[model samples]
Target: MTRVLVTGAKGQLGSDLKELSVHLQNIKFTFIDIDELDITSTEAISDFFSGQVFDYLINSAAYTAVDKAESDKETAFQVNAEAINSLISVIRKSQTKFIHISTDYVFSGDHNIPYTEDFQVNPQSTYGKSKLKGEEYVLQYENGMIIRTAWLYSSYGQNFVKSILKKGREKEELKVVNDQLGSPTYSGHLAKAILDIINKDMDNSIPFKPEIFHFTNAGVCSWFDFALKIKELAYLPCRILPVSTEQYPLPAKRPAYSVLSKEKIISKYKINIPDWKTGLKDCLGKLGELR
Candidate 1:
């Protein structure tokens, strides 16, 4: 059996992975959140790894409060960057494959085209910078694999989809920013992709390679487009208006164009990616909000 350790078991991606794990074969998952293990403490990680050995460690824990990270930079780096260093220090001797989840915020989002893996990263927010630091630590590890994703949402947690669903039903009109463009990733789909990679590696269908990869649902749209689609799908009779980013000022600056290119992961893993709309529909169905 393949022993896999998944951190951030309470988050959307981790939860999705746990739910999906039940249907798979020859894999035993040990899910832990901060309550079970404090990743920020190097001694804590060392002690945890003392008795247990895992074939793979899937790190999904992160400081994802984008606007809040502007003021709480220390906590953000501690969780996002320092914790990764701690994990690497302990896992180095065990030779465990480390799969870390990252965000599209690592880019400046100034381009008109999709972001490739090798594009020069220029993060514009505190959250992005901190995540980038974590990526640096992971890159230094010979066994590390970084999967950068964007606009993640799921049925299990608080996300844009749930937020829009709630407000769209209660409010008569809504205004969303039209300038920011990116792809929406359903955490369920991402969870499946992760498991697919792990299974392929274990079965020798495709050997595991330590490299950065991008994963997201196909197609791109702005926040306004996203909200409009949500309203349409939920059958909410609300007027949705599109506004510029300037109209809605946020504490943390978001990438205007952070759509990640899926060519590398798709071709290398031979995984079929669903369109964003399809993902959204499935997610809504899971939430029992699909009309």
Candidate 2:
């Protein structure tokens, strides 16, 4: 059996992985959140890994409070960057394949085209910088792999979809920034993709390689487009208005064009990625809000 350790078990991606694991055969998962392990402390990780061995470690834990990260940079770096450093140091001796989830924020929103894996990154936000640092740390491990994703949401947690639904129901109109553009990825789909890679590796269909890959739902849309779709799918009577990013100032700078190129992951893993609309509909159905 393939023993997999998934951190951030309570997070959106981690929770989705846990739900999907039930039907998976020949794999045993050990899911743990911050309560179960303090990844920031090197000693804690060393002690935790000393007792058990895992074939894989999927790290879905992160500090994702984008706006709050502007002020709480210390906590963000500690959780996002320092924690990976500790994990890599402790797992250096183990043969565990480390799969770490990263964000699209690592790139500056200055491009008009989809960012390839080798795109020169210039993160504009503190959160992005910290995540990039974590990516650097993961690169030190020979068996480490990084999967950078964008605009992640799920039925299990608070996300843009749920937020828009709530605000749409309570307000007559909602203003969403139209300037920012990226793919809206459903956590469930990402979880399945991760598992597919692992299963293929186990079966020797696709050998595991330490490299960065991008995964997001197909197509691109702005925040306004996302909100409009959410309102339409949920049967909410709210007017969704498009506004410029300048009009809706946020503490953290979002990528104007962070649409990641999925060509590498798609061709390499042969993973079928659904369109963003389909993913949104699935998520709404799971939330019991789909019309």
Candidate 3:
């Protein structure tokens, strides 16, 4: 069996991948949440990797408290940067294939067009910088892939979808940024796509190195537009006021437009990753199971 280790297994993506394990073949998974495995500790990493071997390591663990990250950069770098460095060193010796999850924050959202893998990265915040460093470390590894995804949400964790639904019910109106634009990726969709890519292409020429690939649901929308859809689908009576990024200023300087280009991932994997609205409906339909 090809043993796969998914770190941060309790997180949204990790949990989604865990759910995906049901339909998998020939690959066995070992999920380690923070309690089971601490990625920040070298001693723990050493002990874990020394005892059990894995063919692939999917790092979904991250210091993802975005607003809190602005205040706790050291902790963020420790988990997002230094800890990833440790994982790379260990995985390198085992010659393991690593799939490091990263964010779209690496790019400055100044561009009007969709962000591409080859585009210049100009992160505007500490969180973005730290995640970019994590990407750099994984990219340094020869047999690794740094997948950059954005606007993610799921049932297992604190995400935009849940937040919107919660707040919409509580309040008569909500203010979401109309300026920021990106695909609202349901975590399960990306999880399935990543697994499919690995299942199909583990052997050939090994296409890209530390190869940065963008994966998100098909199509695009602003935060305001996204919230409107959420309200409509969930049958909530909430008036959404589309505001600029300035109106709802956050500690993090998220790019105005971080919509990642999916042509590479879509074409290479030949998987029909659906639109955000379609995926959202599936997720909501199963919201009971999710709950």
**TM-score on alpha carbons, each prediction:** 0.99, 0.99, 0.95
Question: What lDDT does the true structure give each of the candidates?
Answer: 0.95, 0.94, 0.87
Task: List runs of model 2 lying over 4 Å from the truth.
Answer: none
What pairs collide in candidate 2? none
Output the number of the lDDT-best candidate.
1
The C-alpha stretches of model 1 lying farther than 4 A from their native spots are none
Superposed by TM-score, candidate 1 places the C-alpha of residue 138 at a distance from the truth, in angstroms, of 0.4
Our tally of clashes for model 2 stands at: 0
The predicted structure with the larger lDDT, 2 or 3, is 2
Candidate 3 on 75-145: residue-level lDDT in tens? Answer: 99999999999998998988888999998899999998898999999898888899998988887889889
Q: Candidate 1 or 3, higher lDDT?
A: 1
Candidate 1 residue-wise lDDT, 234-262, digit = tens: 99888999999899999999999989999
